[model samples]
Target: MLIEQSPSLPTVAVVGLGKIGLTLAAVFANNGYRVFGADINKGVVKTINQGKSHIRNEPGLDHLILTAQTNKTLSATTSTSEAVARADIIVVIVPVLVDDQNNIDYQFIDGAVQNIANGLKKGSLVIFETTLPPGDTKNRFGRRIEEISGLRLGRDFHLAYSPERVYSNRILQDLKNYPKVVGGLDKRSLELASNFYKQAIGCELIEVSSLETAEFSKVAECVYRDVNIALANELAQFAEKKDVNMSEVIVASNSQPYSHLHSPGIGVGGHCIPIYPYFFINKGLNQGLTPLSRKINDNMAEYAISKIERGIESFVDKNILILGLSYRENVKEPTKSTALLLIEQLRNKKANLFVNDPQFTESEITKYGVKPISLNDKAVSTIDVVILQAFHQEYSKIDFSQFSNCKFVLDGRNKLNKDEISQLGIKYEGIGL
Candidate 1:
């Protein structure tokens, strides 16, 4: 039911209430749209209805969700079919993954589409916010919905593709700041979807010619990052052999307007960077560059390990502490964390291991079969080598030189103060320094 004072806005159903989806639900509700969040997790639904935020990392999201629940604008349910039946607009943002062989797995997305099609109301607009292959939005999902829901395309229902572009910790701000990229099955679908997003998100709407363009644009964004990061990594590796600091070179080269170089790291992780390139590769695009870039980024963990082993005398019993576990700093989700890859390589060398991440509890860290110790603990001082993986803010508060017996600190992110660590008479090594 629509509220009397806010009857002008259409109701919204945000499916797959995970990181991006939950924030989308809260923001839409705060914007005076009655929103129903659909998730299979009953515990998550229960927590949201109680005016609590399931994800604690997103700034201002707790308050946004609380205000929405207090104003009775938002609630959640486990039934996707029921949510779609009640709303005028449906948004899908589930996970799409690649298997070990780099094959696209549509299990989660296919499930969401099936449920959405079951109770899809006539005249309702459907928008997909997941990252998919260039044609999956129109050919796979749009066609499947038309078949299952028995709704004629462009006549009985509308469909659009608007890939979720928000970062993990900056969803609310990105939602209002970034332009919403949208494309549709037809002209009318494009117009309706574009107008709704303009008011609902309170942001500029960037419309494309078709759904394929929108899908391809998102994949291209990830590919750009992946390819550039690979280039940076290649340069850093070469600079390491030549005794030249790649970090300083990056700073100098990126000064001009034409040059925009990314920082090299141990590895590229997260849902998008590591996974999206496979979508095009699976499509059999006769492109060697994308595949080669993916290979370079994927091999970085092994490269990082080799760098550590080159300096360290032995790894048989040396206590090695890896800082941070999540894919990125200050975020809890660890879909394809570089730390996991580093750990695998370290384990092969028979190094005694310990791990720490502020986002995870001590018990949680132990689940990975490693001891968890704090910076102040005596055991931390005995660590032979320290590897900075995620660069969480908590690591910033500690003194790096205080590790009494430490041989060197390998800063994978190159974010540490090189001067300070070196001035303190403690050895510091960045990716190429």
Candidate 2:
């Protein structure tokens, strides 16, 4: 049941106004809680205070902000101290990214902890929503916050790890649909954290024994997808070699109800899937554990890159037109996206590249130093190679006839229907087809 009458809801200090942060803040504020958002970016804070949105991907966010501004239930601040001064609950939703060597770089999380610790008051509940390797909560968040604030855990203050599960472009829906997993330093911390989320969202909160377990659970879920996708990609390659349709084979196998297989794509892209497996692998190597998952995911990128290289080689003097540049369809976040890697490989080969995406503008695409080409532009017809890097709805609408001059269509996403492209007299190469 949605709690519409929470006059005693706790005051929330949401530090980090990014995509995940803003969605969380809006959800709490909309449910009759006093929410304060803090971010280093003053412009984003100002935009929110004015009932405007800084990020476009979050749905119904502007309305939430407008209501917050009108009701005076939500406010923005640049001062961490000011943000945390009166809050009963503090939520940290910042990114804990991995380095090139697959090491967990905790600099971002460390800075956030310092800011929160410096301003924490006794009895404040700190919730770490960022996904990290196990042992981060008790060793890093719990110890650091309590020690720095001179507070006692489970008494003077509380700490918990509840991983964020919202998917980009579908955060609002997923937040309610997905069951939340939470773990804390102690039982008291877990109870407090569970009660807090219980008021705002209708999802079940499964409390675990320790914060480390909670952190590991989130990473494990992501790594599972990474490894499975890697397997699917490998099978896609094998199918291509055997001239068998992998998609049909998957469908036939799935008929048994026990065999479930994911779709095969050119490469895996997304902030979570590509990055989380590395944390498991790197930490295991440090402690002497098997890095089977990491090896598969790392090789997946290389394998997908090889396919693109082979596709490029099939055509001479190829002027490749990349259909999608953003990491995934309908999202503007391209971090760790395979298209960037493919672009780098192509640039080294000196292949002329033209990139276009509906979510980003010419200025955004040009930041990569590649020439920006639009699907509506006549140049779409003149390319020698067209790779469907992203299956954006906008790109799917474009008539393949526009690419009449193209020699080959590399459907990395298996996006184009084979009969449609084949009837157009264009040679098509799709992964797993």
Best by lDDT: 1
Q: Which ranges of candidate 1 are over 4 A from the true structure?
A: 1-9, 419-426
> Residue 43: error of model 1 in Å?
1.4
Over the full model, what C-alpha lDDT does candidate 1 score relative to the true structure? Answer: 0.88
How much is the lDDT of residue 269 in candidate 2?
71
lDDT by residue (tens digit), candidate 1, 124-158:
99999999999998789988999999998889999
Candidate 2 residues lying further than 4 Å off, grouped into runs, are 1-9, 285-317
Candidate 2 lDDT tens digits, 271-322: 7987877667777643322255445544554565466566456423568888
**In model 1, what lDDT does residue 423 have?**
78
Candidate 2 lDDT score at position 53: 79
Per-prediction RMSD in angstroms?
2.1, 3.5
